[model samples]
Target: MYESGEVAIPLKDRVFGRYLADDVKTTEGKVIMKNGEYISHEEIETIEKENITSVRIKSPITCGCVNGICAKAYGRDLAKGEPVNTGEAVGIIAAQSIGEPGTQLTMRTFHVGGVASSSAEKSNFESPSDGKIKIQNLRSVVNQAGSEIIINRTTELEIYDLNKKLVSTFRAPYGSTLLVKDKAEVKLNDLLLEWDPYTVPIVAEEIWHFRF
Candidate 1:
């Protein structure tokens, strides 16, 4: 078993000025004095209270100020050590510490694409208009997306600029047809749908572009 100190002394002996050379331990190797504390009257009292009879002193108990507590001097003399992780909640702290520079991002509008409004009559498809018309409606599928996407008769579309800033949202109005169902793969040239030129199609582009 590990003993308290290297040299044993009787409890009655009063070594007035001394330094604990090594960590004092119980007979079973439990630590007592942590090896560097200045042996002061207070420490002695504590040792006496714990009934520790003797303590080992280093080869030299080399401190001039034995009259008072040497803790301040010992602390100054102590070397700096690497930081220890206390298993703190670092993720929470990091999240909180992050600063948000501006106000809330994103527009208030939301859109659901590929759904035509219910108010549009299917009979509108019977008559043909002179404008260029494209016919397919499919959605671009993402790898992680599910196999099914259900689009009702109404679909909403939110448009954003290249900067990812929200520009506007479009909900399929009356007289529009929904050509694509859920989870369909579509490309840029794929037809979104036939647009009523007299109404919302190029007229929309004209209004946006200020083309009369």
Candidate 2:
């Protein structure tokens, strides 16, 4: 029997039959108490958990049309004597505010830690003694591990695979020594040695989730 007055009800004072004057919009809009909705203890607990200030109770719908001023629009029917429903549900807005950014966070690229790189030497005519390993495609294995400086002077280039067995494997020098350290971040070409054969590992695969 809520009429048409705006009043605030304390959380503790809320009992059965009291309509939540405000729409409990968080995950979704929860209308705890409508014009004739029965309030339950669970609803009260929800209000407390959500930390809503107070509840809006119904008041007497006093008609002020005597002065030729219709309190409401001509065709608009008042519910329980109150104006057209003013309760608003903004749960969607709340959802998008958080959800949209969260989606971007997932799709967007981020630097992941604990990422080490592996590689196989590109096949070419260059020899290690000359400080140049002939890699068929320098861009492929070169970027995997940072640029290399060959001190081994061995014609056989040692390439290692840091990743596990999946399907494709570029056999440069299998079971070779690893050049890149665990969890490294590098920008622009850095000279580790004067005559490094490989290129800097600029693009790394740290997050395994994104690899597949």
Candidate 3:
């Protein structure tokens, strides 16, 4: 219905008696109209019932020096956002690419206060088997609570059964306090070590109010 030379038009604005430029098919591959078929009121009603918004109509037949095939190829290129002419500058293409909606993602990040990114804090290490505990490479200091807090990173705790066979090995991070002494007997799931998490809890020891 538009006065311009545009081939595709909205289905509501499509001119009756014009020919279909391409085949129109349903989503299930049923042909609604074949290429070059004349569009009449019946065809328009059928297409509208199919919920088609736009349709391509055959362009006016032209004479003279114009190559219809070449014109169609250029039209397809223009529709696809491809450069219509050779030697198009790369900067122009880059600008066009950046202007697309897909390239406009926000760089903003969101974070919740007081939520730690680390995994769940482990406060205690339990013995994995019934065995005697043997400590190695341990350097620790006894706290006021009479707990031996390991200060070294290389400490390895080994568990050996009654036959002196190694049952399991355990390592605790620095600042971990031993719950069982060296050569202490422990059963499976028994407490072997304990430590506070790396992150401290936020506490307000004193309350003060300020008017803003």
Please tell me which predicted candidate would have the highest lDDT against the true structure.
Answer: 3
Clashing pairs in 2: 4-59, 21-56, 122-135, 122-136, 147-198, 147-199, 148-196, 148-197, 148-198, 149-196
Q: Which ranges in model 2 have alpha carbons more than 4 Å from their true place?
A: 1-9, 14-16, 27-35, 61-212
CA lDDT scores, all candidates in order = 0.40, 0.35, 0.64
Report the lDDT tens digits of candidate 1 across residue range 1-212: 11111122445344334557678676667786787655656666767777675676633245455453243223222123222133434345445555332112244344434544443432222212112222223222212223222123234443334444544333433334444443343333343333342443211211133356
TM-scores of all predicted structures: 0.22, 0.20, 0.39
Model 2, 119-182: lDDT tens digits are 4333232211212222222222232345432322221322222332222212222212334332
Tell me the spans in candidate 3 whose CA falls farther than 4 Å from its real position: 1-106, 110-119, 200-212
Ranking by TM-score: 3, 1, 2
Task: Flag clash pairs in model 3.
Answer: none
* lDDT computed for candidate 2: 0.35
C-alpha lDDT of residue 47 in model 1: 77
Q: Rank the candidates by lDDT, best first.
A: 3, 1, 2
By TM-score, the better pick of 1 and 2 is: 1
